[model samples]
Target: MTAQTGYQDHKTDRLARLRRVESQVRGVTRMAAEDRQYIDVLTQINAATHTVQEVALGLPDDHT
Candidate 1:
């Protein structure tokens, strides 16, 4: 089989996850602008935090 070129699935998946994290960050910014409920904002922040941590942990040690 011919060797693959360019970005591979492993790298692509990591990038896709990071993109979602970026969206979550943008949502947090919007919440601040709209003066959302304190608890509401915190809840979203907590969810985003876990998403980031999961992505970080999922990456191979050598990559990190």
Candidate 2:
């Protein structure tokens, strides 16, 4: 789901999303380190990538 940032972007919202992505990355890293199945790790990697991309797309286009 795409978020509408408009003029006043919510700091808490952005931080929360970033934190979620960070947690996802950490989990994927741990899974890989523990020699988890390649397919399983790849699935998580794809999920994380999709989440990060979604967050990136939600950012406002205007710099100001």
lDDT winner: 1
Task: Flag regions of model 2 displaced more than 4 Å.
Answer: 1-8, 61-64
Please report how far candidate 2 places residue 31 from its true position, in Å.
0.7
How well does candidate 2 score on lDDT at residue 62? Answer: 35
Per-model CA lDDT versus the true structure: 0.80, 0.77
Tell me which residue pairs clash in candidate 1.
none
lDDT of 2 at 10: 58
Writing each residue's lDDT as its tens digit, candidate 1 over 1-64 gives: 8976334547777787788889988999999999999999898898889888877777655254
Which digits, one per residue and each the tens of the lDDT, describe model 2 over residues 1-64? 9875563465567677778888989998999899999999898888888877866776655334
What's the lDDT of the predicted structure labeled candidate 1?
Answer: 0.80
True lDDT of residue 49, candidate 2: 86
Show where candidate 1 strays beyond 4 Å: 1-9, 61-64
